[model samples]
Target: MISGNKRTERFRDAVAGFEAAVRAQDADRSQQYFDDLRRYFGEADDQDFRQAGPRLAAILDEMPAAPRATVAVLVGACVERGADPTPCAPYVLAGLAGALDDARAFCDRWAATGGGDFPDPQAEEPPEDLLDRVDPDLAVAWLTLHHWEMAAVALLDHAAVRTALDDGTRTRLLRTLRSVEEDSGYVFKCLAYALLVLDDEPLVVLDRPTGTGYALRMTGIGDNFQLHTLLADVLIGGGHLPGRAPSAEEAAVCRDRPGQVDTIGSFNLVTPLGDWVWNEGTPSDIPVVDGVRLLVLDPPSYQRSWPAGRFFPHMKGDLVLERVLGADEARRLLAGCAAADG
Candidate 1:
């Protein structure tokens, strides 16, 4: 076992090296330092690093104060390198708590510098019994952290519900989102919300006319992170109702709908507006008609390796559609439609 002092020295050196490489704009060097940092945390093995959570947490606690973004980057880097910090869920949670505290502090400092009254930033305390509720394995912890990180963003912004973030931070957060793309719809929604909040321009939500009902869509220059979250919130908050599940009747009706419906797999149907899945084997090509409006969730990528049917399970009378396209794809599709309309 490594001595505490030795571990501390290793962490500090690794952090310093990473920072230096970033400053030098040496992508290769920065990545090398990141690898070193991961190795220091016992992620040298191909196995998920979640087993090393305790060690990783101890090292983080020993470090001197660092910037909120820096902390996010470090943790993110570990995640990117496949180090599962789940076993150290408590430590990861604590780290998140610390980062939130740091964000509040930074905001306060900024307020003071501007001579403005400090906004009573909300304090988000991670659930004390998180470990009790979640497994301490790396995958579980990764999912848990993924959930909390997005929640932290909302809490930090006081559930701004409409606040935007700096471009740099937005990009960094999106990169992190990309890493967790294969996780679940819940993770994707959180990432989308983060991107929406970080965008520098105005966004509009559009609803596609499907038969008599409508499906909501978001149009923007960059990632439509907000739109995805909005869709998720709508689906979740709408109670995943039994009526929402596409039925054989609806599928037949959808076939004649505006967009062509291609069955991607046993469970899913890819439509122009959005993808849909059904518990029954019969696939439907449904268009977003009425009753669908984009409402901000106020919450909230990757080639899926799993088969479509197994990937999205029917949950309590509802089916989940993972993101079929990224922001750029959505834009291109919409742009082509607009051109044709013109």
Candidate 2:
């Protein structure tokens, strides 16, 4: 049996060689290295895949044209190993639609077949709590659901991907996605919104940023670790609800019947837009001024917020970090701009 360190070392070496071959455009060498990488993936434990997945994905992104078969392999291995597919989502969206279908199929099969009925290692013959006996695969799948939400959001904002996909392709992809019944409906809504963007819904700047001392760049928004919490909250209809407080009767209904109605945070937007609600994790159909929209990432107690505001120029394919703007400057620039439609 290979020791964990030895296995990891071999996996890393294979990845490095594969990256070099791909960059050199040496088809035979790349294929050979890919075979080695696939073998490692097949033999990998959770820790091995977790460490290698992102590195492999980053390399794929830098390639001029990501190999579809290689993308499919990485996605399939992630599903089979119960790893998060987030890292590979860009490739999946960029025309390898079947990969997403295959991953979803694997997820569905796992759900139908026992869905993790492993015996509890620590418990007695018959475990009292079924939760304790859940197979790690199911737990990993549950965690991956969160990643799926982010992926869905990316699909919405990926303009380059939309340009590559025609109407028929978008429709087919949407149908494929709808065929799968997930554990939660939130991802479906997010995905539906993304599909809408692919069809005809023009991508617009959704918010106006406020707050001082914010810097901006053009890079992946996921790099902003601080906004993760806020983004998740907004995605799940958990953003601040302002206006008049809920009536006594409304409060009682929410308290007594929790699942029936969605709950929301009891705060107001720090950077309030005229009458816009920041519920959905999307930009509104606001008119873009000179191909630019304002995005603000304001944490509760601002410490060292770099991108407190971003000036996005009509992004279509890959999302980037645009230039930064001060709070006062951003507000001044966006003062006259209004939503194209409600």
Candidate 3:
């Protein structure tokens, strides 16, 4: 950890660089600064963040929205980064006050009830060279362990998700992998199947066999506010309604952006909250969905803000997504798979 004053300086530098990047209209630079800010919180002396985080959040929040990512990421980073230590829990919880009121309340409720750590286990070490050959669906779970933490700990006992996996036997999956992230076609497909089973909605993956344009067949639309964008990023990173999924670089572009949607990526999202927009390098204020599977995308890309409320898979926005499917299509695919198993 960087020592006291130096840690403070690092915190200031991150906020300063981000603010300057936004003011200068440097999209990429602002993104870099945001990434640095996240890193500072993680690496700076843990206690120093207790002082700098809220101040940094206030400063970032005051900046113009066009050049900066959302203030929530900055604030969320503070809470998550400081979460490792038991003593820092209250301080970290304090940082989540406004942006993650739901999460803060959860912390209170969970604490008052005498519990800690969500359903997800903290960390595990795997034997060397063991994780390399893990099944793709398992590989996806390992990746989720890194990105989303416990929110990715969906039940494996579910019949549909279990049936969807390539291997019925757990042999050869000896290692519990951590820190390795490789995209998997199986992970993409299985996540879709699992999500469809869980949502129990008529989900669909709006996509073509080739090229871009991806989203869900959404209904009973409501305000996306926070949950939709976070889910979109996680869904994409894990692979989504795959008309065409994002390449590695494209995923970075979407995750780093302040709002939902990226100029370069191929995916768009429609959530009950709102639609994921600005798809295929076009700025579309109003959505255009014509076909039965037509997509109306959401505009804000994924950022971390509501993890305390269990809103996203990752605390920060850096990972890539692929092999995607939307809700309606996911349901359809699962049905087919179930029939085949039967």
Candidate 4:
């Protein structure tokens, strides 16, 4: 029993650490945590780990996503090494599918803007009544983010990624031929970068400097962490940048409602899923090699987040921060700008 308790403690820690890495959007941290998990896996016998599979799966699913990319690789490795993960098979597979869906969505969303193409800084109209479903601010954020992603995808597909690859390599990194044939293929890097950037959304901004504030160079809008929070956690923090974060009293007035940022100390229970399930556990199945392939996206093609260079040298990064305005107000603003230029 003591042994089991110790294992559980360590396992939970490892899982928590991995999830934290993912949320932090640091590949190196994620890899290191995964390595810790692998070491822990070896500490116990195959049957021992297998018995805990369901628990692990439940934990992983509790989070906003499952770390499918890592779990899939771990499962494959265990199988190859003659370890039986049967007890945990169902859980692992569940996490794998969920993680893959999130990854695919994340990547496909942003990769559309890859290569030398640029995201249109200008905002566009939403589909009919889109604002009714979500706040005007959130609606605009989604449109802008989606546009940038589309531009990225175009940049990636335009020979920059394909210049040096056997068909197999390209397929693995981009899509299997079958998927492309069926119009179902998606880029691995797309999923990877999506998660990375989104993880970087909820920043811990202290008044005092801490290892350089969340400049969020890659994203547009100086101090634009709020938009990412809306996307990643599906709730914006309570406060506007030009002003202080919302006060507890102010937040109390607006709590439990959509279309508003949350209070700083507010309970995270009001997440998109209506509860706090974050950091319970996360799984990833993307192999180290695939992660390496995503290195090209490390640098912000448009902003200054990474110390790395742009994936598309020909493309230039421009800040694309969101600004809210009514239809008439927008027209007036544009007209004013045009006149000023003239």
Which lDDT values do the candidates have, in the order given? 0.35, 0.42, 0.35, 0.33
Instruction: Report RMSD (Å) for each prediction in the order shown.
Output: 18.9, 15.1, 20.8, 21.5
What are the clash counts of all predictions, listed in order? 10, 13, 41, 34
Better of 1 and 2 by lDDT: 2
Arranged by lDDT, best first: 2, 3, 1, 4
Cα error of candidate 4 at position 1, Å: 24
- Candidate 2 lDDT (Cα, whole model)? 0.42
Alpha-carbon RMSD, candidate 1: 18.9
Cα lDDT tens digits, model 3, 165-238, are: 33412211211111011111112222222222221112333332222333433321112322233335455545
- Candidate 1 deviant stretches above 4 angstroms: 1-43, 48-50, 67-75, 88-90, 110-210, 214-342
Whose lDDT is greatest here?
Answer: 2
Q: Model 2 off-target regions past 4 Å?
A: 1-91, 94-96, 99-186, 189-218, 222-273, 277-280, 283-287, 295-342
Question: Candidate 4: which stretches are off by over 4 Å?
Answer: 1-39, 64-68, 75-87, 111-342
lDDT of 4 by residue, 1-342 (tens): 468668756755665677677566667877777677776865555554454443333344333221343354444344333334344444443443333333344334444434222223243543554434444433333333333233233322222222322344333533422232133232334423322221112222111111111212122111122222322222223222222233433332222222333323311211211122222211111112212110000111122111122222222222222332344533432232211110
lDDT of candidate 3 at residue 35, scale 0 to 100: 76
Lowest summed lDDT window (length 10), candidate 4: 292-301
Report the lDDT tens digits of candidate 2 across residue range 1-342: 878778767777887888788778788887788878877765666766666655565565444332434544464354334444455455545533543455355455545655654322223343444335344434333333334434434433444444455778778766766654443232445555456442232222223333222222222222222122223233222222212233333232322222222223322222224343342333432223455434433223322212211111122211222234455665664565443223
- Candidate 1 vs 4: which has more lDDT: 1
C-alpha lDDT (0 to 100) for residue 84 of candidate 4:
41
- Worst 10-residue lDDT window for candidate 3 reads 174-183
